[model samples]
Target: MISLTNLSYYLGSRALYENASMHIKPGQKIGLIGLNGTGKSTLLRLIMGEYQLDGGTISKAGDVTIGFLNQDLLSYQTDDSILSVAMQAFERQNHLQKRIDGLLHEMEVNYRDELVDKLARAQDEFAALDGYTIQSKAEEILEGLGFSTDDLHQPLRSFSGGWRMRVMLAKLLLQKPSLLMLDEPTNHLDLPSIVWVEKYILNYEGAVIVVSHDREFLDNVVDSIVEVSGAKLNYYSGNYSFYLEEKALRNEIQQGAYENQQAKIRQTERFIERFKAKATKAKQAQSRVKMLEKMDRVDAVIDENARVNFRFNFSTQPGRHILHLDDVTKNYGEKKILTHANARLERGDHVALIGANGRGKSTLLRIIAGTEPTTKGERRLGHNVSFSFYAQHQLESLNVEDNMLEELKSANPTKSEAELRTVLGCFLFSGDDVFKKIKVLSGGEKSRVALAKVLLSQANFLLLDEPTNHLDMQSVNILIQALDQYEGTFVVVSHDRYFVSQIANKIWYIEDEQIKEYPGTYDEYEWWMEERKANPVDTKTAAPQASSNSNGKLADKSEHNNSNGSVNGKKPVSANDEERKEWQRALKKATQQSEEFEQKIAGLEKQIKQLEAEMASPVVVADGKKMQAKTADYQRLKTQLDSVQEQWEDAMLEAEKLEKKLG
Candidate 1:
């Protein structure tokens, strides 16, 4: 365990932490959260002794060991395989194994009793340390962090920065130090990897302190929240969601106390002003002045939540079909990214494309944007459709010499300076901050500028590839709000679950070399996926009788059968007349049931929307009891809606199978 006592740290003349105190307990999972530049990562370094604290103490037990996983480790390079790198954590066992090998080698040459005795002792220690299973342990950890078994043998220098970072993380986890410190661990992770890490951290035996902006990751992994604000560390004894609710209540009480203190001060000042000149009340007035001077002033609460208020508009209204891909085939050398994949994007569609790494999400985005050529396919854009693509690499396309304001001006030459400034302000660049040159901005700052430019592109269709990268929680929330209010169609690729859930109404994933669609929110899609995993469907047996042709039209099965009742060189059995009649009756009943389920689903959706509106009402929000009741009601309705939706989908599938059989 480690404890920071009255910690005070400064960067030049600016104080990053002033009298910030936090005691990390054994086996505790803590999340360090704050706005960018608030020194969340800096605190971790201070604890690691990389930086000298300006004041106070960081004390830990002499036996305690620490393992830090940071961005700086991304530059690590070696020819050794990642498996070897990770197995290096077992230093004692490795040394013992080497000793055992040396003793055995000596005995082979000299046949000495001493060598045999030494070899026996070394082997015993190695076995006690579980050295024999070290390689397997390293492999499991590396693969859990998203590496393939084959990738474990690749040279560490052969991987990219992000993948290398994962290797370093695997090494640290294998170390099993007393205290684990991770800075932005999820930044390079995919959704599945992130989930894996969360589960791993939850069951870890050691203490953990993570600095991350990922809300859902924090909610799932951390048991306590430590917020850095106003040069001090504020502790919350619960997860991120609990911190938000507790902070709200604390701010409400603080605001009231501040107002009351202000009122009291004003009254005392007025009394002093009126009675100071009078002979009878002069002493009392002077006493009251001292009391006013000595009173502790209550600090007003600072609102950290920022809202996006600018309107995102385009000049043209797109046609009903925004884009279409027919039998699209894309390949890079021997790698097949997409093979005969067909998909359509319509007007007003908000889609989130997500999956594990190397699924070609960005490649698909570029293909949709018409920037990447297809090996064999047709991509058609609807009438009046204008589009803009945003990605992390686009940051390099920015003019570093230009200031943020000038960059926005270049993005939209028609918008007035005032309008551009307002847009920048919504992105947290206000007043003179907008005058800073792009070259001087940090990665997060550059990301905000690029996002602002994309919003101002005046395109009805947007393709965003990892737009949430390098953004803080507040910035992510602001982008979500803007996207929520946007009427234009968009397909975004992101690994941030909370951001995707908030902005996207539809979910898309690549499976079996084809783009698959789920007509629901990310949360709903996740639930459906879980259901499928729990009760997996066998696609080989579930294939429908009718299939789509290259033109995306349904091909009749009868066309493939001969008049002699032979299909594809196989004999077809004929059903009895009564059986035929029974099949027809069943198909009719299934179709009607499917139709009824659709109507019920529609009604449930309407009711859920009404409940959402009610929960958002000002009156309900102001009353704690009423708000709680409304929230409970909303959750209940959502659960019901999910059940009904599942039922409806099953009914439709059943109807489809019956129809296919009859045809």
Candidate 2:
């Protein structure tokens, strides 16, 4: 167990934690939450001994091992293969294997009994640690974090910085320390990977403390919440949802007690003031004054400025049908994403697009916003349906040279500086912060700025991709409130279930190259799912009734297939014949694309191999310019190869689906 007993920590002259006490018993998953700059990361550092305590003690069991996921990506070995780095988690097992090998060599050379005994002991230790399964286990964790099988063999330096962090996280999980403390672990992860982390943490046996802005992640994984604010700690014995409910009740109770205490103090003060000069009442007045002084004062609860106040303003109302997708298909080269997917959105419909990572949730949003083109079929936006698209990397799109005020001003040139500053203040930026350059802001601050820009867009439709990616709980609630009251349509892709539940009146579940629509809130959809799962008999027979139509609208398969086939009262081309022709054309196209992608991928791979060989050659190493040129070519080819490979995989899936239909 790890315990913090009346601990105090400081950031310069500011007290981040003062007389804060908490305990982490075995298997307890605690979520550390606070506003930005409230020392959530600092407290974790203090626990890890990266910072010295200003006062008090943090005691832990002697055998305790801590695994902290620091934000720094520079700590991992970039020169090593991803798999090799992950396998380093089993350092003790590696040592045991080495000892066993040494003992075997000794036994062969000298034929000694001592060598045999040493070998036996080493082998036992190796088996005890499950050394043989270490590599597989490491790979499993890495795969869960969104790494491909091919990625495992690639050098860490080949990947981008965000992916490299995932490699570090994979290593940390493999280590399985006594305490697992993650600071914003989901920052770089996609929705699927975040879901995987949630499951992994829930099943984790060690004590866990996560510092995150993801409310759904906390709700799913953590059983306790430790809120750090105003140099104090407030503990809740439940998840984020429960914490909110309980905290509100507790605060209300505190307010009531404080009000009652203030009333008594006021009455006593009035009595003392009225009788202090009267000789008959002097003694009683004196007694009352002493009583007042001795009484334990009930301090008024201080409610922080925890939420941003704003509304999403729109210039015009959209037509009833906000957007429509008819037989829409999206693919990169041969890699198919959405295949014949259809959907329609009506005005005032707040839909959530949810699916696994790389399954085209964001891609679909991009398609609808006209930022990306559809590979096949059509997409139509309703009249007056102007949208503001907020991509996950919207912060990166900001001009680094521009200040926060300038960025907001760019969004709304007509708005005055005072008006822009007011909006920025709503997003927690004011005074000097508004003057700060966009480049120097932290992830949370940048996210707020991006949100502020979106708020100023005043578009009637919002296409937001992972808007809550770097926001705090408070900011999330603020956005939720804004969207809840907004009179516009939106299709937001977020892994935040709470935020989605709050805003989404309809859900578009994209899975298996198709979209499924559910008419109702996320909660209702979940309950319906649970009810279906509970009755296996009903579930088995319900599949045919729930298939989607040409427009991706939910319908009875029998009725939809028969009625929707005949358009404009014309006798439709035989459904099977049309389907067969389409599939045949798709198959031929996919096969040709797949072959072309294969050739490109092969060429790129060959080039990469040749470059690696040349880089390893002594002659090339001796020439810096030659080596640099080869390395650059190698990186460029590798990136192209990755894209081609993705396309090839998509083509293969499309081909398979076509073949199955043809058969």
Candidate 3:
């Protein structure tokens, strides 16, 4: 457990935390959330001792161990083999094991009793730490993050930045510290790795605090929500989704009180202004004016103004035939990155390219974007095709010396200063901000600036590689809204499920080096997953691990620590009776606001039923236009109703399970 007692931090004239008090109990998963540049990362760094507090103190109950996965981990790279780096944590034990082995050899040769005793003590310590499971744990953690057996010996330099982040994650998991602080940890991870991290955190002992823009990720993995704003921290005893609904309701209530107070003040001011000039009620007027002047005005809180709405603008209409790939083969020496892959992309298609990390998702995106070529296949871009590529590693493309304005103009020559600045403003680049050099921007700022450039490209087709990286929640919402309205084609490789759900109309799932298409959003992909689970596929045997896992077979999940202080394989939480109880308790707390989530869901359900009944009624059939309108209304209602229904069911089950536990 960890505790913060009247902790305060100041940067120049601004105080980040003013006597902030917080408590984190064991077995609790906390989500740290706030607007960008609100010092969420700084607070974590303060706890991690990367920074010093200007006032107050952060108290600790005993020896506390902390591990952090910061955004600057991209620099952790080397030509050294992967396993060697992973085994570095066990150096002391390894050295002891080696010394014991040498001692045993010497004892056998010289018959020394002292060497035997030392060897016995070393073996005992090693066994106590679960040394036997070290290899299994290392392999499981690495593979869960999408490293292959062959990749085990590969040098760190072989990986890209995103993959390097995975390596950093592996190192932290290997350390197994008591307090794990992850700031936007999911930024560079693929879905598979994200899921693995979620599971690992769910089961991890001690406490976890993750800062992420992925709403669903935070909602599923975290138990408490810590909202830092206005130089203080407010704790909500639930996940991000729960925090959102609660905060919204609380704000609405506060707004009402503020409005009422303002109205009273206004009335008193009006009465005093009119009555002050008249001798008839001069005494009363003086008292009224005094009350108005002395009253402490209730300041209505306003939302953060930093949210922006920049989006890609498309000009050329996509051709019916957008792209074609036939018998494509891409290989790195003997290791095949892609093998005999074939696919076609049509105009106005919104596709998601999914696979385990390092399975060539970005490679295929680049190939489609025409950045590179396949070894044995033909790739074709149709006529009138104009596309933009948002690189997974975009920083490499930016010239550090170039200012924000220069960077935008360099991406596309046709953009005007006025037009470019107008668009850049949406990403919070304004006035002198546009003149700031790209190298001077922070990671989040650079990410937004890169995305701003993509929007100004005016391409009809977008090929994005993890486009949501470094974006805040508000920025992501703005982008999602833009994508929903834009009449363009997109092939986005992203791990943010919420982002994909809002805009993706089709999917191209890449697994085992093959691509499969689905006609709906990413949610439908889950149906495909369930089907595959019901009809299991033996991927290792069926395709020899050469082709992709098309059906997305059920992956085995397991967890254990080796005798030598190493965690074994990872596993998903099964939500048995006990686990379900925790979920229910959280749900119960979430539903206590004035406008209960259950009531909203019920109201929506009623509306949907009414709309369905009316649309189905024979009377509407007589008027073709009216019938069509009714049908459309019915469909819209059904979608909303379905979403509400899912939420309702989850909350009810969780509540029921917790109620029982409490009883």
Candidate 4:
């Protein structure tokens, strides 16, 4: 267990958090949340011993290894490949292995008995730590984080800074310290990679502390959220969504208390004033004045969220079909994203677009929004359908030299300086933060700035792509409430399931170059997916139903045979057509088998992903032995999967050979 007593951090003259205290036992995943500059990152730095506390003492039992994913990527430095960068986490293993190697080189007979025993012990320790599998483990972590096979051999210096941050995260997870403190770990990850990381965090055995804007990941991973507000750390025992509901109730109670106290004070003052002029009531009046003076006051801050209700109004009533994209096709050179895709979006539809990473959910939205054009077919927007797009890469648009307040001023000319600061405060930016240049801001801070800009845009049709990317739980809740009350249309692409459930009323699922709509919230969509699994469509039966043939033509078997050619067991086709029929059957079988393998692979991949996400939590890396074991298991499973994949691939090759033989 780790405990801090009256911890405080001083920033110039102001204390970001004063006398704040918290605790962590074994195996509890926690999320540290606050507005931008509310000391979340500072708190993590304090815990990691990177910064000294201004006041109060921190207590920890013996060596508690901490793996921190700092917002800044300067900590993990190497000129090696991405794989080598991640593998650096196994430094201790590498050190021990080196000693073992040196020992092996020395002749055993030439060495003293004591030297021989020491060498043997060193080798045993290295093996027990699973030092032998470091290379494979590093490769697996890199691949799981969306690194391509080519990227493995590619030097880390060849990658951009954002990709370098991913490599940094991969190292932290590979190290698997007792306490894992992640600051916006998912910022650079795509949907599939995010999902993979989330799954990894879930199965992690040690304690975890995550600082993220992705609500769905928190709801799935963290058991609690610690919110920093009013220069204090407030602990909430719930996930991101839970914290929102709880905070809403808590805020309501606070508001009532303030109102009631003010009302009583006003009544007391009135009575004292009325009796002041009367001689007989003078004593009572004086007594009342004394009583009033002695009364304790209820101090309450104004609710910032109450201010920025930039009511988005549709400029024009769109057609019944607000958007129509028929047989839309797109490709980047030979890499096809969407092929023969079709979809329709109507006015007032709260739609969510979802698919695996790099599958073009955002690209399709861009195509719909006209930021990008489809290669073929047409995407038509209804008359006067105005849109406010929130790109996932919003931070890229920010001017690095501009301060927070300046950015806001530039984004919305009509917004007053005071009003912009208040709005920024509501999103967790306050005081000097408004003066901080964009270049020095954290990923989460940049995300908030973008979101704050979007809120002020006042567009009726909102298109958001991963809007909850770098937020802590508290900010996400505030956002959820804001979106829920929104009366206009929303078309968002997010992997944050909780946020999607709160705001989306319909879903656009992209699969096999098709956009499928699930006309409900995330919960309803999930339920529908479950139903489909429980009652899957029988391909053999559904095939005939889906086939289109003129009824007049079907009546003639001769014509049908000329087109399709029947099999011998059912009906005779062309002479010597058995091989061709068998080929078709094999293809069908392979398709089914491939789908099944993909599903299994998906499930395994999901679990692995959860493990990565859990690694980002504050709990998993907070305990020594537990973190070590969790990481050991992660490496072991990765190896098992690789071996299994090799076998699976071989089986598939055999199946393909048989298919060719039959043909």
- lDDT against the true structure, each candidate: 0.86, 0.82, 0.75, 0.73
**Model 2: colliding residue pairs:** none
Model 4: number of backbone collisions: 34
**In terms of TM-score, which candidate is stronger, 1 or 4?**
1
CA displacement after TM-score superposition, residue 363 of candidate 1 (Å): 1.5
Measured by lDDT, the strongest candidate is 1
After aligning candidate 2 to the native by TM-score, how far in Å is the CA of 162 from where it should be? 5.0
Model 2 lDDT on a 0 to 1 scale: 0.82
lDDT of 1 at 191: 92
Better model by TM-score: candidate 1 vs candidate 3: 1
Give, for candidate 4, the lowest lDDT window spanning 10 residues: 544-553
Q: What's the TM-score of every candidate structure? A: 0.82, 0.75, 0.75, 0.66
- Expressed as tens digits, the lDDT of each residue in 1-663 for candidate 2 is 998999998767888989999899999999999998888999999899989998999999999999999777545556889999888889999899888888787778789887788888888889999998998999899999998898899999888766888888888899999999998888778767988998999999999999998888899999999999778888999998999899889989989999999999999999999999999999999999999999998778877545545555764445456777767788888768887777777778898887566678878888887778645777787654688988867778999999999998899887889888878877777688889998898888888888888878988888998898768877787788778887888889877777888999887776567766777788987786667778655432333224244233445445434455753222443457778898899999999998997788777767777787888899989999998988888778767765777677678758956775576
Backbone clash count for every predicted candidate, in the order shown: 0, 0, 12, 34
Model 2 error, position 622 (Å): 84
**lDDT for 561 (candidate 2):** 42
Q: Which stretches of model 3 miss by more than 4 angstroms?
A: 78-80, 155-158, 271-297, 304-313, 399-402, 409-418, 537-663
Query: What C-alpha root-mean-square deviation, in Å, does candidate 1 show against the real structure?
Result: 11.6
lDDT (10s digit) by residue, model 4, range 482-593? 6776666778887777777888877776655556566667797788766776888853222111111211011234433444555211343333568677767776776667
Best by TM-score: 1
What's the distance in Å from true for residue 116, model 3? 2.7
Q: How far off is residue 467 in model 3, in Å?
A: 0.9
